[model samples]
Target: MIKDKPIFSVKNVCIDFKVGGKNILSKRSVLRALNDITFDLYKGETLAIVGESGCGKSTICRTAMRFHSPTQGEMTFEGKNIHKLKKDELKNYRQKAQMVFQDPFSSLNPLHSIYYHLERPMKLYHNFSKTERIEKMNEYLELVGLVPAKEQGEKYPHELSGGQRQRAYLARVLSVGADIVFADEPTSMLDVSIRLGILNMMNDLKHKLGKSFIYITHDIATARYVSDRIIVLYAGHMVEWGDVNKVIINPRHPYTKLLIAAAADPEREGKVELPIVRNQESEVTVWTPDSKGCPFRLRCPVAKSECAEEFVNAKQVSENQFIRCIHD
Candidate 1:
């Protein structure tokens, strides 16, 4: 059974990037990719990070994987601070945490065969002998539904279909014996017919293999299908989060409501439109440190003067759900 305790924790993490100034003579400025972002990833559960493009969904996944360091706050794995680990310790940490990139085509080496790709991780992390490696490779290949493992092993990346390549990537992730998998838009590039199959594979990995996953996607429908908990992000800030069902059925934040309403529904064709707040239509704004009050106040229909002047505090609305809104 999955534990209720957190396996990974991101506490008040802020990520900043130094960008070039408008003019050559002007000073450089900082872009806040993430602002005070905090969440816990529990064992054997899929935590879905859903938002529009550039809302820092990928940024959070990268930060969790130790690809990017946070300017402020801390990230811990199994009670150890990931950012403070030594070289050897960091290597060990990586063995437990792995990432599946969006594009399967680019992720795999065109020159190498599938067996070579799968065998390398086993060799690196487990230090298995050549015979042992081949044996394990076949086993993992079959485990991911790539049957007749020996035949599939000899094929290069280009020989495989998009869905097969993705499956191979998942097999590689398992070969490393990863406990946590960070999947960034894993199904965005695939055919619509195959997307569900990939999602089913992920579900099997989580439930049958007992692996934890961080699924980042813009598709709210898919997010709801795959996640136990959901976090809604806006302008690098967590607008709403909690049990997926609770948050989706009863979204409290104006931004969260907007996202849910924006989900694609075939039956509602031509009838659906972008949300307009208080007769005032607004577009998504870029993140800035100088902005005050709520980051979403500009587009909030129920926003008040206080929302534009002070930072909003998170309040527990349900058993495991929290919202950062004053009105709701």
Candidate 2:
């Protein structure tokens, strides 16, 4: 995968949202959603962003999709900085990189047909005639396994199941000739049985379509299934990242171990001992820039006083492993 250089790269990206406050001291304060996130997306590779719920997985997705510009650092697409792209350049960039949102129900327009959703992007990106666009729309519908392509395309968002809606949204992404896809927890809202289908489709897209994907999810099992490399995120910071199998088999960071332990394993016998983490907040925006040390220190079982004094950068464990812990 590294032979053909990275198609996209996020260099020390940081995102901060200015939220309203109740007290005078908290007035117009910045909440860091993503902190110094850095990664490279090679062609036809699926990079999974694994994290606990509300750990700002979506924030990374939105930032890469250009929904939220980074407060610091830059996002480079094809070696060109995305944030500096002009209007037309940005439009072209958007055509190449698309987002499959987490909420499939709300991602598509309720008033429009699935065919319309597919056609709009094709119309914008390709200067095809109406008939040609219609043909391509049907092709995309069938491409995502929406059989009886014309029939499925003619139906509205509400007319389809949650899985079908998600497929339709993906088809729309492919319709625009997207080379890089940011799937922000695409299967989180779907039923357990149905999620496998979506994951299979993504794997097929990754290998078959030769598309680079950023698969964000809280499920480590799904992450291992669909992704080539995995980045374990905690409180908006990347605690561990490496080859999927490497990280899954031997999790180094406390947070990564906890996340992997949290997964459902039918084969494992006896009661599992999960991490005894407490005083954890669902929304981790309270973790600030000035707040020293590791974010997981408060809850980490092996954290020391130094973990509270200053932050530690990710330590390289192997050729394909990295972890952000005070220990070796």
Residues 193-292, candidate 1: write the lDDT tens digits: 9999889988988898889999999999899999999999988999899999999889888888888888877766576665666533357665667767
TM-score of structure candidate 1: 0.94
Question: Model 1 lDDT vs. the true structure?
Answer: 0.88
**Which digits, one per residue and each the tens of the lDDT, describe model 2 over residues 1-328?**
5437899998998888888787877777677878889989999999999887767899887877778899999999989899889898899899989888889999999999998898888888899999989888888888789989999999999999999999999999989999999998899999999999999999888888898899998889999999999999888888999999999999888878877777889998999997665654522436766666788888787888998776688789988999888887
Candidate 1 regions exceeding 4 Å error are 22-27, 267-270, 277-281
RMSD of 1: 2.1
